[model samples]
Target: MTLRLAGGIDVGSCTTKSVIVDDGGNILGSHVLYSGTDFEGASDIAWRETLSLAGVSSTDSICVFSTGYGRNSVSFATNSLTEISCHARGCLHYFSGPMTIVDIGGQDNKIIKLDQKGLRVSFKMNRKCAAGTGAFLEEMALRLRLPLEKLNDLAKQADGEVTLGSYCTVFSGTEVLEKIKSGAALDHIVRGLFHSVVKRILEMDTFTDTVVMTGGVIEHNPFLIDLLKTHIQNDIVTPPHPQIMGALGAALYALQEAPHNMD
Candidate 1:
């Protein structure tokens, strides 16, 4: 029997994601893995797991597309697309109308503005600092001796307002410890961390209205949606699985490539 299957693999700084879809644009399987050493090897591991989850074999698959930071290194992909283009296509697949995409991954964050048809109009990225990225949060979590999820949950419980004073992780970590030494409430410090991340994103402050958030951080901290909502001045939207949006977008692009196959 022949199977018309298309796959997409996303290799990010912290994690790898793969998505497989049938001709009808239905997800057959998906997997997430860590990116270590060469991305080519990592993509293979991620794709193998995804195939296992879908209960399929290499012989049953068709074209594969790759996206994300390491797309160029995916030897098996028929083609590669930039993460920004893939993300726009993916978000447009899930929702329509004016959209602004905010993706906070392990090493960086991006603000992408899309038009009504899901076309990217403009975008800004922050790769220079860790303050707005997951790396920053992970370091802060280590300092606080709290699981990252617990940090966000703790932030949700804050009774008093607090602000983190530094954009640099080292300075912020020092200040955070000082606060703890002074008997400051744990929730206050947690809230301050979330606030600092939001503040850093606001520094880009380029897009407006219909903000849609996607990334692993949101997966761990759903309360970030509310915290972000408080800071933004426009409508907000998020998909059911924002963390997988990049991979999903890549799959969506595969579908678009063969519309006749997409039922």
Candidate 2:
């Protein structure tokens, strides 16, 4: 019997992710790339790379779904979904039972509450400011004159004693500079920044016992997970590919919808 494949593309504000899966819900291939200024171009590249890794061609009969900020830009999508729904479904793919999802993305952050049956109970999002998003971290890294990739390691080396008083990104940047001028330890400052991120998420909403985090920020700086765990004092988890959970969820949706499309 021939195998059926399904594809999902998530065009986020800062990154685009693509995933291909088999009928049995197993991932075959996935790819991630910067979204840049062209959402369509990024989606095409991500989709092509994912297909190549899956050893499939563009002509294959795969159901395609898209989600995220640029979901509407995916001209090839069979359908598009809201990022909230996709994130909830994607996180639930790995973890069962009622849970909370914290997705920290480039431009914004989301907190989704799910009931025992996997239905969305409610959600909160922060889009008015960059305080708790990846953009905030990048700006902080720029102010610190450190590479963005070094944040995780530097944070891990800290004593975790430092705490930033400001939650606004601009104010936090000024605060970081003040700490530098005061001869504060660099590692401590980094950890403090991570602390701010966790604090921001905590203020977003109350979480359930099981909290699953997903998105590019978590994928890169996993130490934030440890920080969050300490604060929430609850079970926390992340999927295998945190950055691609939206795309993976989209693919899972495709798998379910594919049968209806059969000739």
The TM-score of candidate 1 is: 0.92
- Which lDDT values do the candidates have, in the order given? 0.81, 0.90
What lDDT does candidate 2 reach at residue 38? 98
For model 1 the local lDDT of residue 143 reads: 93
RMSD of each: 2.3, 1.5
* Runs in model 1 lying further than 4 Å from the true structure: 1-3, 258-263
lDDT of 1 at 81: 88
lDDT of 2 by residue, 1-263 (tens): 56778889999999999999988889999999999999999999999999899988753578999999999999899999988988988888899869999999999899999999999999989958879899999999999899999999999988754779887999999898888999999999999999999899989899876989999999999999999878777789989989999999999998898764344
